[model samples]
Target: MSLPFNVQRAQDRMGIEDPMADDPGLFHLSRTERLMAFGACFVIGLALSIIGSALVFTGHLAVFAVCYSLGNVVSLLGMCFLVGFKKHLKMAMAPVRLTAFIVYIAFLALTFVSAFAFDIAALCIVFAICQYCALAWYSASYIPYGRKIIKSTCGTFAKSI
Candidate 1:
């Protein structure tokens, strides 16, 4: 079997000699640039974590402080992991994000149910706040990095960010 003409024509027009050709663009990320971006992300995570922890000691701030603190801690750890295990962390990001979204929705359901059934309004509210903080931390950590990495790795699809 052979590839159809449209595919061949498209390839020819794009000047792609081989389907598996390595675009020089993919290799454009200098080691120094990677290091700088990663270091900035780590600093941001640490700063956010410190703020969250401070809030936790601020006279019973419902569950928001606790949630924020916990989320910030985990996010900082995740950032560290990403810096050290770049390939593995990148591979896991998509699945981890998807799973978090689904779980976030499920937690919303549970929060409502618990509020109604157990009258734990404060607790429920805190849980939701915690979830939001975690989401924010995770998003802050990866979304920027994801964009940069994807841009660098997009081969011919690469365009200005």
Candidate 2:
């Protein structure tokens, strides 16, 4: 009979045993942890954007612009549901704001493109600048809210919905 190719392949040339064979399980993120992870993703987005801007008159763009844009949209929705709509005011909201901050940094590339293409009129540019100004202003606004949310999450109080 033919040997099981799959089983036979397991015997590597090095003869190393399956290192993961004894692992009980893998790590899984909690709901809150997932949010944090998603929020942290924005930071990665910003870094990619900077690197992209340096290459090919804007390289690494696929990861930064498109991916970051997607992240922004997802973060916005999460904020709406977990913070804004809940209006529970908690420190947890801070992560979402952090996401926004990351999104804004990523937007610089888009702004550059728009500037070159003149996508928006002077008013558009002005408005875009103003938008970031307001976003920055409000990023700090959520600190107190975030504190409350954290308290709620930690079961200190029913702060966030």
Candidate 3:
């Protein structure tokens, strides 16, 4: 099956030679199969996150933190289906994305440390919010002019305020 124009273009830009390329002695899947895996991982991650949020009111902060952090990690791993894991890491650490990636990763780890190690619910929540914001910034880096648009909008709002 042929890839959509946008997907094809993205693959070209990412330097992917073949969507069907397989790791030796490992699972071999077509683009459609990879997409299905990605979808499944995404849904599972979303469900975990929702479940974690619900658990917050149940007084299980630790569980909530574990579930929420795992959800984020799983969702991130889903991208490996589109680009190989190494390629994904390489792109994530590219100069344009490096700072956002570092901040996002730091917050992700801090969220867990605050919940489990420090046992501070408030700190965990704060770190989680920071993690979310970092993830958003990292994601925005992917779209053309997305960060610029966000900055301009925020600046306009600030000026209005």
lDDT of 3 at 90: 77
Error of 3 at 50 (Å): 1.3
lDDT of 3 by residue, 1-161 (tens): 56689988998899876634543112456777778888988898888888987887787889989888788778877777766676778789999999999999999999989988998888988998888788878878867799999899989999999
- lDDT (10s digit) by residue, model 2, range 105-129: 5554554465455544343344345
What root-mean-square deviation over C-alphas does model 2 reach?
16.8
TM-score of each: 0.32, 0.31, 0.79
After superposing all C-alphas onto the true structure, candidate 3 shows an RMSD in angstroms of 3.9
TM-score top scorer: 3
Please give, for residues 1-161, the per-residue lDDT of candidate 1 as tens digits.
23469987998898755312222123344345444545676676566656654654554344434344444445444433333444434533666565654455456455555545655656666665656654553454356476445445665465544
Clashing residue pairs in candidate 1 (N, C-alpha, C atoms within 3 angstroms): none
The clash number for model 3 is: 0
Residue runs of model 1 more than 4 Å from their true location after superposition:
1-29, 60-97, 104-161
Q: lDDT of candidate 2 vs native?
A: 0.44
Candidates in order have lDDT scores of: 0.50, 0.44, 0.81
TM-score of 2: 0.31
Question: Which regions of candidate 2 are displaced past 4 Å?
Answer: 1-32, 52-132, 145-161
Cα lDDT over the full model 1? 0.50
